[model samples]
Structure formats: structure tokens, C-alpha cells
Target: MASSRSRRVEYDRFIPFRSAMDMDYARFALTMPSRPQRDGSRESPSSVAYQKLLDECILKNRSRILAFKSAPEAPASMLPQFDEPIRPQKKQQRRIPREPERVLDAHGMLDEDGLNLLDWGSNNVLAIGLDDTVCLWDDANKSSKVLLQAVEDSGPITSISWSPDSTVLAVALGNSVLALVDPATGQDVNVTEEDENQTPVLSLAWRSNSILTVGRSDGTVVDYDFRKDDTSICFYNGHRRGVCSLKWSALSGRYLASGGHDKLVHIWDACMPVSHHHPRRHQWLHRISSHTSIVKALDWCPTRSNLLASGGGRNDHCIKFWNTVNGACLKSIHAGSEVCALLWDKNKSELLTSHGSPKNQLTLWNYPSMTRAAELSGHSSRVHFLAGSPLGGVVASAAADETLRFWNIFETPKTTKPELPFAKFSVIR
Candidate 1:
């Protein structure tokens, strides 16, 4: 009896919600006689004999289930005993309204890939491209100034981006020229010499205050160091068509994402060692070729360093999320129209996308869940651009209808100390 007690396997503890078939299987397993070779250990005769009567003998009788008894109690998991403190309930997300907070008239025949033409500077200024001119609107003062007017032959302003420090602005012209301007004094800082190849600069992204990445119509991407001579530091040549978008990772500033009319997005490593075989050329780390149309929208996650979001144009009309660490696609959703621009909310795990024809509206989505939170309609034409304000609460969207709208979709940032840009630096004694 003592030996039998030692092998008391709690196999008949019926888990709550278990089906009748499950109980029968459990009984079959529990009633099986132990074979001596099962664990390379011989069961004692007395224990084996006991098991035969309680398990095998009963099964052989063919009606032993009728004789079964209820288990003494449920397992510990079903108990109500406390094991840890209760966690506070998560704060619910604030719902975004379907109507925008404000709207303004903006006139321009904006280009198809005009993602950079509308940018909100860190200095609370909005830079907008209207026809052949570039205008700066200060949100604080509610005033406007024209920063640049391109000559008709020079081509319209294709793109404009502010440096990380917000001291200088980089403008790309359709004629394949770049100009750096100071925002405070509204003066030209540096203008690049016309490209000998004359490949129109289609997109611009600032890697740093003095380092800028330029995407051209010829599918070549150039990294220029403006600290001195505006020398080309690296060249990424993978796209076969015009490069429409270029965005650097806001987390580590190590990964650069480029998308284009080639229906491809390439992730490039900024710190790659130069190859002696091709000194100036650098190969891409991951080539994502899932989109079926022009991919003009690309943005790195502000919350997750390894996650990226890309959107396709009219033909594809899909938004895809990717694990940049391995180039694995995590999720994809059909937007039903051209996804012209994408942005992630800084205060929440949410995503916003601007669309083209059919709806010509802005969509706010709950991340990971991918559920629609709000669909805002205002643009009379394709909403080709989106820019978030410096304070992280408001967003400005530019559409082909020659108008810009502001929406209060994000929560106002909480009062918190700004993180040190260079964490390693400290005050010296």
C-alpha cells in the first residue's frame, strides 16, 4: 500500500471545461499498466498488482467508467488564493475625432512624390511648397514668409527637410540642385553645384546637421557631408527608377530606408565599411520587394527600433509592417486606395496614413491591432503629404486639392525632461 501511494500520479484531475472525449483519453492513459522497460526500471510486484486492479483490471471489465469517482478538488490554478499584487488597469487611448481641428487653403501643383514638400520644423515652423515657391509658416505667430522661389527653368521645389538641430533647411530642386538655408535669418547657407548628370533631386533626408542624404530620379542615393565641401560620403544605387522616399531611423540613426518607383524598399547600413573593390559604392543590407506599385511612404517606428512601416501607391494600395532586423514582414493591410504618406504617433502605439482617390481621407489606426480608430475626410483631392508638429499633438496634411489641414489627433505630450542627445557627455569639473 505504501509503495502504491508513492506512484500516485494525479492523472485524473479533470481540468475544467475538458470534453468527454478528453476524459476518456485521460482514463485510458491513467489505467495503462506500467511496462518494466518504459523507464528502464522494474515496477515492484506489489505496486504492479495494485495498478492492475485500479487501472488495467477495471478497463478489461468493459464498464469501469460507470464506477469512476469525482476528483477530490481542482488544480491549484483554479484556486482563488492570491499569489501577487494586482496590476493597475491600463489607461484607455483617447479617441481621435473624425473632423479636423483646423484647415487652410494651400495652392500648388505638387509633384506625385511630394512627401518632403511639407515638413514641420522643430522650431514650430511649417515649410510648405506652393507652386514654384517655398513658404515658411510660424505656428506661434501665425505669420508666413517665402523662403525660396525657384526659377521656372530650375524646376519646382521637389523636397525640403530640416536638419536634426533645426538650424538649417535642405531644399531639393527638380533640376538636380540642393540648397541649404538658415531658418532664423532666412539666408542661404550652401547650395550644391548643378549635377553634371542633372539627375533631378527627388527626395532629401538629413542624417545630421552637416550630413544629408539625397535621392535622385536616376535611382542613385548620395550621402553628402556638408561640414566642408559638401563631399559625397557614400552612394547607394539599387533602385532602377526614381527614388521617392528616404528616411533614417529615429531610434539609432544607423539604418537608412529608401523606397521608390521600382516597387522596392532597401534598408542600408550607415556604418558599413567601405569596400576597396568599390570605394564609393555601398550595398544595401535588406531588399524588400513586396509592394506592387511605387512605394513613396517609409518611416521607422518611434517606439520600436527594429520595426518599419511602408505604404504603396494607387496600384498596390497596401500598408505593410516589417521587422527590419530580419526583413520579415509582420503585417499587411489593404487601404483600398493609394497610401501616399504614413506616420507613427509619438505618444501612443498608433499609426496614421493619408490616402489618394476614392476617399482622399486620413486614417488613424490602433497599432498591432490594426483596427480603424478614426477616418478623417477633408482633402478634396489625394492627401499626398503628412507632417506632425514639433510639440507632438497636432498634425498638418497637404493634399493635391491645394489645401492643408491640421488635426488634433495625438495627445499633448506630458511634461518631461528632454533626453540628452549624446548620453555619454557630462559636465566637466
Candidate 2:
């Protein structure tokens, strides 16, 4: 027994125990199975001591091992990689389809050159010039009446325009005169005629309550101020032929656009003082002669102030959009026929154009892109005039067929609103 004890102690000295944390020592000590001694009993003292030490070591290190495993600050190299990559979010695009809600017939409408035949008032009244008569049609009540008539000697009514307040209407006659009439009573409030030079008034546009610009057959536009003692302010001359179309920009009250049979478009600053001594009576911003035929279709963009769109006659068959600020031609589209009139959508970025020969149709277009949205064909003759209602999204077109057509092309879609037809669209806006 003494000799066996000595041998066991010598084996323990060869083990070289440094610390209990050594994984190899712990595995060897803890995993070893008990063996029977020479006396035929179970575990020996050295083996028993090792088993107790291993148990104590595991108990002491339990909390530390658990804490290290649960910590979140693990190195990047220890993180697992993913197979699939993340994608970016997609944006939704808005696309409005081309469709008409309804169309109406307007009889006794005229198709004349150098005439502002159709106009829509804020009170929802549409005034149309038919031959020598001026007619008023109530859009809300759907009624029509003869507003005024000119004698055969005085010639036919050439142009008509409603005031901003919808109270007064201006009627241009072929006899070089302009008659301001109250639509409520169908009576002339005042009549203003051109000077003795005998130039007839062809087109008329009202800029404000005090300002009226009249385009003449002598290639000049006369500014009439209601506030001044001498109502005839001055004349602005540019075109070499009859000025057929005149429009004042709503965005900038000072900007005016005039087109004529001379195949020229003149952008003028109307606010400039008329001085014959200054060499240039009118402040001409741009003189665009891109049209090969009569440039009668002229309109300023309501959404964009500096953008202008003009259409040409049968030979040109093109609608060109211009940037008034820089005098640049932004876009141009061929209508396949003569572009006679233009109307810009107020609530949306769209354009409505009327054609004369070949097609004689009304076309709805998307702005900037100049893409055709839809083509409305009904008129048997040339579609020459277009007017928009202040009630929103309703347009009335007059043609040479002596018919006026109403179209709800820009009407807003509403599924949840009540059936208040007249006020529904205006209320939503």
C-alpha cells in the first residue's frame, strides 16, 4: 500500500496543474471513468479529488459563460451573411385617361375670321356670336336667348368678350366700333369706335376692369382705359396683316399675345408707355414667325405663366408651345389638320385644340409631352372656337357647322360626394 501511494503522488506531480480553466485538463479530468483499485474497491483518492475540482470549476464559471454568449457587441466577422438583397421602394405615377362625359349641340353659331365668337362667363353664362347676332346661353339652367343684334348696314359682329366680373360684355363690329353691353338687360352700356382712319376692330380682350385691348385689321392693337379721360390710351403695332387673335395673360396682366393673318405671333409688354418718339411704340418681347399660314390660335398657359401655345392654319397644321421668358420653342405637334382654336385645362396639365379642314374635330392633348389623349368627332364643318366655363372642367366649342358643342372632358371623378351637381365640382376645388 505504501508503494502504491508513492506512485500515485509521482503521477500527480507529472500532471503539472496550472489553472482549472485549461479546457484540455478539464476534459481529461472530468471525462475519465472510475477504475477499481488493487484492493477491489471503486474510485481512488486522486480521481475523487479531480471530479470534485471539475464540478466546482463548472459551477464558478456558469454566469460568465452565459453573459459572454448573450452580449450584443459581437465582432462583425462573427455575424452570419444573408443570401437575398434588399430592394428600393417604387414610386406611383398618375395617368389620366381620355374620355368625354357628354356633348351638346349649339345651333346658329358662326365661323368667321378675326372673330372672338365664344366666351364663358363666371356666372356660368356662355355668349356666342352668330352672324350678326349675339346670343347668351345659361349653362346652369340650360336656356338660351338673343343678347344683341346688329343691322346689315353695320355689318356682322366680329368679336365678343365677357368682363372679369361677368357683368358686362364687349361686342366688336365690322364697322370699326366696340359696344359694351350689360348682359342682364341686353342693353349697350357704351359704344367706342376706332379713329376716322376706318380700321375695323377684329378681336377684343379685356385685361381688367379698367383695361381693354382691341386688335384691329390694320395690324395694330389699341389699348382702351376706362379710368382715363381719353379712353383711347395708345396703339401697339407689330403684325403686317390683320390681327385676328388677341389674349392677355392672366398670370401676368402686363403680358399680351397677338396673332394675325401675316403668319406672325407677337409677344408684347402692354404695361410699357406708348411713345412715338422712343422709336419703338410697343415693347415687343418676341416676334415668332414659325407658322407658315395664318397664326390665329393663341393662348397663355394658366398653370405656367411664361409658356405660350399657338396654332397655325391649314398649311401649317401645327401647334407650337413657346417659352415667353426666353423666346424658346419648347414643343410642337402636328394636328393633321388646321388648328383653329385652343383651350388649356385649368385643373390639370392638359390642352384642348380644335381643328378645321380634313378632320374638323376636337382633340385633347397632354402638355409637355404633346401626346394625343382623345379625339372628339361630331362637327361636320370646321371647329373654329373653344370656350371654358368658370364652373370648371366644362368646355363649349363652336364650329362652322352653325353648332355649339359642350364637353365635360376635364371633370373630376368623385364617388363619395353628394349629388350637388352645380356646386360639387366648384366646392371640391
Best by TM-score: 1
Q: Candidate 2: misplaced stretches above 4 Å?
A: 1-108, 193-196, 272-280, 413-429
For candidate 2, the per-residue lDDT at 126 reads 90
TM value for model 1: 0.75
Task: Report the C-alpha lDDT of model 2 over 244-308, residue by residue, as the tens digit.
Answer: 99989988887899999899999988666656685436767899988999988999999889989
Query: Clash pairs of candidate 1?
Result: none
- Against the reference, the lDDT scores of all candidates come to 0.85, 0.81
**Can you list the residue pairs that collide in candidate 2?**
106-404
> What's the CA error at residue 2 for candidate 1, in Å?
36
lDDT of 1 by residue, 85-157 (tens): 9899999968677778877878775756634688898899999877778899899988888887887788888
